[model samples]
Target: MVLLDGLADEGSETVVKPVRFRIGREGVAESVGVDVGWFTARGYGELEPDGLLRLSPVEALYLTKYGRVAVEDDSGHVMGFEELFSRLAEKTANLWRDYVIYMDLRNRRYVVKEGFSPHLRFRVFERGTYPESAAKYLIIPVYEGDDVVVEELLEYVRACRAMNKTAVVAVVDRRNEIVYYTVSLVNLINP
Candidate 1:
């Protein structure tokens, strides 16, 4: 409640130290509008959800790292980064790798939107830009240890091309480090 109010008046980058939120029975919390406005406008969340906007654990953790919100688990305890990541990783095996890419992009000041279909992680825009415009690139993260086939790489490129965006592969190493590569299947010229 208070967190939502604070986020309403503030920018997303403003650190809201220990912002309070509780995980509900449905796993979605009542803490809508806190990070959604800035995140969505920058293209992270949907414009709206069924009722209150539901945040994924990754989103919550991202905000928390920036001092945006602090989430309370069902046990009425604050979730530390490790616990939160462990809980969320149960559902997604590549959670940590994806998080590494997410953090890298965020640190670079890209407005990163979590990807939906086509097996991508983020649709990225230049800083201070809105999502209504075309995203500059679509990032599909792959762990360095994962053996990537040529077909899968081509598919990612095709998908981004279809969407009129460039394809970027964020190759994450075991140390949680990242290296970005741009892939293209067509010949294009610089303006």
Candidate 2:
């Protein structure tokens, strides 16, 4: 994947990068070029039955951090952000009566809340549905004048660590005025 320091004013609004290999498939026991140990230590793995790797809805949502839409499977299939949001909204529409999305304009941090106040603290339970295993906050950093403000990012990581949940951060480089994408996973016991 091409990595850029920042995005250009024109071109694609959202970029999708494809993965090269399937996780858990024959001859693909490890995450391709990615550090599998981070994911494995956190209990995430491939869907053996379908030959698909399951990204936490939180991680999937984080792909939008870099103005990217979604991360593709080994097959090069791209799933858009709107589609992901629609699917989640559909699944939990009946259970939750309201939805609140938070985006910090200063830092570009975003969080989605369904049937809960933004101030309430929560923990995610892996292997469950949205709101069940969903990260309380989705943090993204947009390069401001000189440095990156990471308050929200730290908060999310801290929350995930305290709850023994996996924290995945998608880092986008926009230095070249061209958009580039990549993902990073950090296992936090206490951020």
Tens digits of per-residue lDDT for model 1, 1-191:
23453554334455455556666544433463354554455444444455455565556667667666677787778887777677666666577777778877877767777675536778888777665566788887887878888898898889888888988888888788888999889658887
Q: Tens-digit lDDT track for model 2 on 77-176? A: 5446564455444444311111211211112222232212222222223333433355533323232243644665566556655654544432323341
Candidate 2 wrong stretches, greater than 4 Å: 1-33, 36-55, 65-69, 73-76, 93-191
**For candidate 1, what is the TM-score?**
0.78
lDDT of each: 0.68, 0.35
Show pairs that collide, candidate 2.
4-173, 5-173, 5-174, 5-175, 6-173, 6-174, 6-175
* Candidate 1 colliding pairs: none
